[model samples]
Target: MDLENQLKNLFPDHVSEKVSEKKDSEEKGIWLQDDPIICKYEKRKGKPITILEGYTGATEDFKKLAKELKQKLSVGGSFKDDKIIIQGDYRDKIMQILKDKGFAVKRVGG
Candidate 1:
């Protein structure tokens, strides 16, 4: 039997139409908050740090993205609380990377 017919027979009650509709909504766009990106230098226990905030993204994808960014910038970084923290000041660099990745990004505080 054809794949479509076989699937229909397997789930007689549930159909593919409902699944398609839900998939359409999810493909619209990556939902991003209207908040400015914030970058700042911080000191933690006498160690210098750089923090980036105002980001909303899925944890797994966020980590993957962070990994790529760190590699690109040739710096060390980590993801925590839905935020990306890269060593040193890399606001412009990170902004450019996100833009290149087709993300609607805006730089906020210095």
Candidate 2:
């Protein structure tokens, strides 16, 4: 017997729910929130690094944002501890990018 037939026989009166399909991809969609995403800078080992925090989205979404930022800036970076760490200090540029994507960005520190 086919798997579907066996399942029907076992459940007897089970009704499978219909699944919905989304034609759009969420990755192509940028999520906007009320609170601004915190953009800050600090020197690590005498080198400047930009850090972005306070993003209350799925980790996958944050990682996608980080990848887009790195590609746009052509810089190396990583997502660690639920924060994004990008090489060098590109606070102004990064903030602009986020703003264009409909995310409120707040500059914090030098």
Candidate 3:
């Protein structure tokens, strides 16, 4: 099954459904929350970086996600402050990843 289908199946609830729709609507952004989950990208020292913040995600799950993203992007990254930071300009990549993971993402800045 496709990623969207998988997410739907994994989270078959109203909240998940609403989030899924929102993610679909917002294609170039990060999904963030104060204490829940936040995903965004930033430019540091002329380098593009993706930061996944406010993630109260489990250790194992966070590690798994980080590993997957690093592998996919072929870059160095880490999980800190309950967030994921990937090296390079990964706005597009991170956006897609979060969308697949069922998070509503919004891109801020050029």
Q: Per-residue CA lDDT of candidate 2, range 1-110, in tens?
A: 99878999999899877565542354356567899999999999999999999999788889989998999999999999999999999999999989877799999995
Residues 19-76, model 3: lDDT tens digits: 4564344333333333534556688898878787655545666676677789988999
Report the Cα RMSD per candidate: 7.3, 7.9, 11.9
lDDT of 1 by residue, 24-52 (tens): 45434444455555666666777656676
Q: Estimate candidate 1's alpha-carbon lDDT, on a 0 to 1 scale.
A: 0.69
Clashes of each: 0, 0, 9
Candidate 3, residue 45: CA error in Å? 3.6
Clashing pairs in 1: none
Best by lDDT: 2
User: TM-score of each candidate?
Assistant: 0.56, 0.74, 0.56
| Model 1 clash number | 0
> Would you give me the overall lDDT of model 3?
0.69
Comparing candidate 2 with candidate 3, which one achieves the higher TM-score? 2
Best-to-worst TM-score order = 2, 1, 3
| Model 3, total clashes | 9
Error of 3 at 46 (Å): 3.7
Best by TM-score: 2
